[model samples]
Target: MPLTTRRRALSTLGAALAGAVALPAGQALAAERTPPVRPLWRAHAHNDYEHPRPLLDALDHRFGSVEADVFLVDGQLLVAHDAVDLDPARTLESLYLAPLAARVRAHHGSVYRGARTPLQLLIDLKTEGASTYLELDRQLSRYRQLFTTYTHGRVRRGPVTAVVSGDRAARTPLAAQTVRRAFYDGRLTDLGSTEASFAALISDNWTSHFTWQGVGSFPDAERLKLRTIVGAAHERGQRVRFWATPDVPGPARDALWGELLAAGVDHLNTDDLAGLEAFLDAHGTD
Candidate 1:
């Protein structure tokens, strides 16, 4: 090789090395950073506590909402679907509150990193509404600013939003709260009549309202009814969710979910975590 050609090659290599060395550590990291994963905000893990790993399983799937059934026993709020299945070790504070607090701290005041919107924690009360909510309030108070608060006429967003479901009687007390850590979940009847400030979500049994079970094709009128319901709720500044629909792993679940998405339903309730995750990804709903 010619002497000048060799000198030029060496100088080029030296300049490249100098540029690399001059790069800031944080800037180098920024160059290597991958875009954040889109959160599946519409996926609601029904009976999330029933899973083997509970909250961890749903978080791994990037689920935005999770439901836990709680029973008030001897001033302790225990999480379980039924009274017969209640376990002392599965208290609300242990399974949810502590872990959520730790996660918010770890993520720097958000459930998801670099995101301001909070994750939804749906607490279904299986016991006496008023008494259970009072105890739940006490437990929530210990966490300070962990859960979202409705103060005066505005909602102060936090790391997590707790929506109270189950026990129709709970509505009376939940509505009466001047300042509370949670919002109430209403039924279909309350869709247009209810305010979003009081009832944040409208949930009902899918089987009760529509006869189409995601079989061959959804009836035209039934689809219209579903869309109507969703539209009404959206107009009223509320979200819609229906349980008791098909959950089995098959085309039926996919069809129903597709229909729900097309109708603009806010949350898709499901017990199968991976199944719903796959469905939502395929449709790009996140």
Candidate 2:
């Protein structure tokens, strides 16, 4: 079968696995086609699950990437920032996978209509990495058509690319997998050491590495360092991102965001979806 046909088949299978929550048959297909919305490809929704509608909110804001923190509870992948916030109802599948699967079907194989670029789903493991990732792997396997997959040294792109982040312990198991529906989120330490097939994203804490917090002018040396890091990662076909940056809405944040854009950062971490969306729009970076 052709790749597109295979994707559609898998999507139908995935919808069946999701039960009633899945989109009604032909509903997505029959829905009117909307003009392709310009997505802020570099906009990363930090703690996206905290938003009122999880994935839907980010999609509404045209964010190309969204992060969801998950914990392993009772053999299930629960979406939460911490253990205390865990709720049985908010599962990875319900909050992310199922919805994404439906959207892909709606768009006839892409998250965004008329666009083949995959939306990035950053899954941050909040519990023990190994166990949590094992559970995550199982969940992702069930919706295989919804995620980008690496199989036997080859990668097949899907509508959404799931990048596994947080919980360093998960690294071992992720590395051990010869085939998986998710990729690892690497840090600067893994820069050139890993391949783009495995570690597709290079993310780290901005505060831990830089002294500048988007105040005044970025230091000359630090600026060079930032660009160098981005350049190195791009050279290896991997993307770079940093969390813990000044997210406050102000000139400082704008300055930092501008600098990041200029430096070719792949994703900008922010809780303010509207803020980033507006910024990216104003700059015509979307």
- The prediction achieving the highest lDDT against the true structure is 2
TM-score of each: 0.87, 0.90
lDDT of 2 by residue, 1-286 (tens): 9999999999999877765334565764555544688988999999999999999999999999999999888898889987888899999999999889878876778888878789999999889999999999998999898889999999999999999998999999999999999999999999889999999999999999999988888999999999999999999999999999999999999999999999999999999999999999999996
lDDT per residue, candidate 1, 147-263, as tens digits?
Answer: 889888788889999999988778887888888899989999998788888898999999999998788989999999999999999997888999998999998888999999999
RMSD of each: 13.2, 5.6
lDDT of 1 at 29: 72
* Deviating ranges (above 4 Å) for candidate 1: 1-35
Taken over the whole model, the C-alpha lDDT of each candidate is 0.88, 0.92
Count of clashing residue pairs in every prediction: 0, 0
Q: How close is candidate 1 to the true structure, as a TM-score?
A: 0.87
